[model samples]
Target: MIKNEANARHLREANKAFKAIKSEKPMTDYAKAQQSIQENRERLKAERLAREVSSKDAAK
Candidate 1:
């Protein structure tokens, strides 16, 4: 059936994508630095949001 063929094609594409991701090399130092910065930014943003919420609750 046509549906079956489409499903097979989708699976093949997905497998190829997974293989490509598995083949990637390790991150360079610059990439590591960028990832570290991104993680720190996310952590800081969460802290800032928590502080704002607490302050708003206190002011009520």
Candidate 2:
């Protein structure tokens, strides 16, 4: 037979997940994204430099 404890545990988990997702911020629009353009550019620049460094090291 199913037990009351099992049902409570399931409900608690479901509600916890629901609350977490509900609390998260939604996607940002282009204007909001542009606000972070400088940060994004720096991140991409760092990635490209890292790749170049690795390639030069491998060539040696």
Candidate 3:
């Protein structure tokens, strides 16, 4: 649960960063957006793994 929450927090932060970058000058930085997206994906994967483990333990 804690890991899930942390992951969510990271995602939210990434979203904010994306928005900020998007709102900047005319040119948008695809690299920064891509990095943030990748980080978000990794965090989500960690959260999913944690949930899977917890669920499996509960089932047992």
Candidate 4:
């Protein structure tokens, strides 16, 4: 029974260590660039939509 408990403890500790390692992976440079580009695209799209709405309101 004691051996089983020790094995469970070791497994839990190992899982916690591996989970920490997996969760803290740094983003690569290419991924960072892609994320930046996506953010810029979304911002531009929002601006364009706002402009179009204003223009339509002006025409009315």
Candidate 5:
């Protein structure tokens, strides 16, 4: 019954994918790997500050 169902379906799927990929900020593998290093530095800094606070409290 449908003459252009395959073409129409392909169009719809392609259009649906366009939006999902549109807003992505592409990062290379090295960039993605470096992000974790920054995160770890932040985490370690927070942990060091927490320990310092606890040590000061214990000293008092």
Candidate 6:
């Protein structure tokens, strides 16, 4: 009776924790991917500008 109730409570708590952890995983991964893409874009833009500046200097 009491033991059964305790077991049920433990199971419920474990399930809730599992759900919370599972739900956050996709959001965390998406945020990391978005950050990586943003960093890559910034790096590409900087490189393009640097090349343009170098070409102009060479022309002068």
Best by lDDT: 1
Which scores better on lDDT, 1 or 3? Answer: 1
Candidate 1 overall lDDT versus native = 0.95
TM-score ranking, high to low:
1, 4, 5, 6, 3, 2
Q: In model 6, which residue pairs have backbone atoms overlapping below 3 Å?
A: none
Q: What is the TM-score of each candidate against the true structure?
A: 0.62, 0.43, 0.53, 0.62, 0.59, 0.54
| All models, RMSD in angstroms | 6.2, 5.2, 20.3, 4.2, 5.1, 8.5
Where does candidate 4 stray beyond 4 Å?
Answer: 1-22
The models' CA-based lDDT, in order, is 0.95, 0.86, 0.90, 0.94, 0.90, 0.90
Q: If both were scored by lDDT, which would come out higher, candidate 2 or candidate 3?
A: 3
Residue pairs with colliding backbones in model 5 are none
Give stretches of model 2 more than 4 Å off.
Answer: 1-32
* TM-score of model number 5: 0.59
Which has the better lDDT: candidate 2, or candidate 6? 6
lDDT of 2 by residue, 3-51 (tens): 8889989999999887755465665798578868978999999999999
Error of 2 at 52 (Å): 0.4
The residue-level lDDT of candidate 2 at 27 comes to 55
Candidate closer to the true structure by lDDT (higher is better), 4 or 5:
4
Best by TM-score: 1
Sliding window of 10 residues with minimal summed lDDT for model 3: 19-28
> What's the lDDT of the predicted structure labeled candidate 3?
0.90
Q: What is the lDDT of residue 21 in candidate 1?
A: 52
Report the candidate with higher TM-score, 2 versus 3: 3
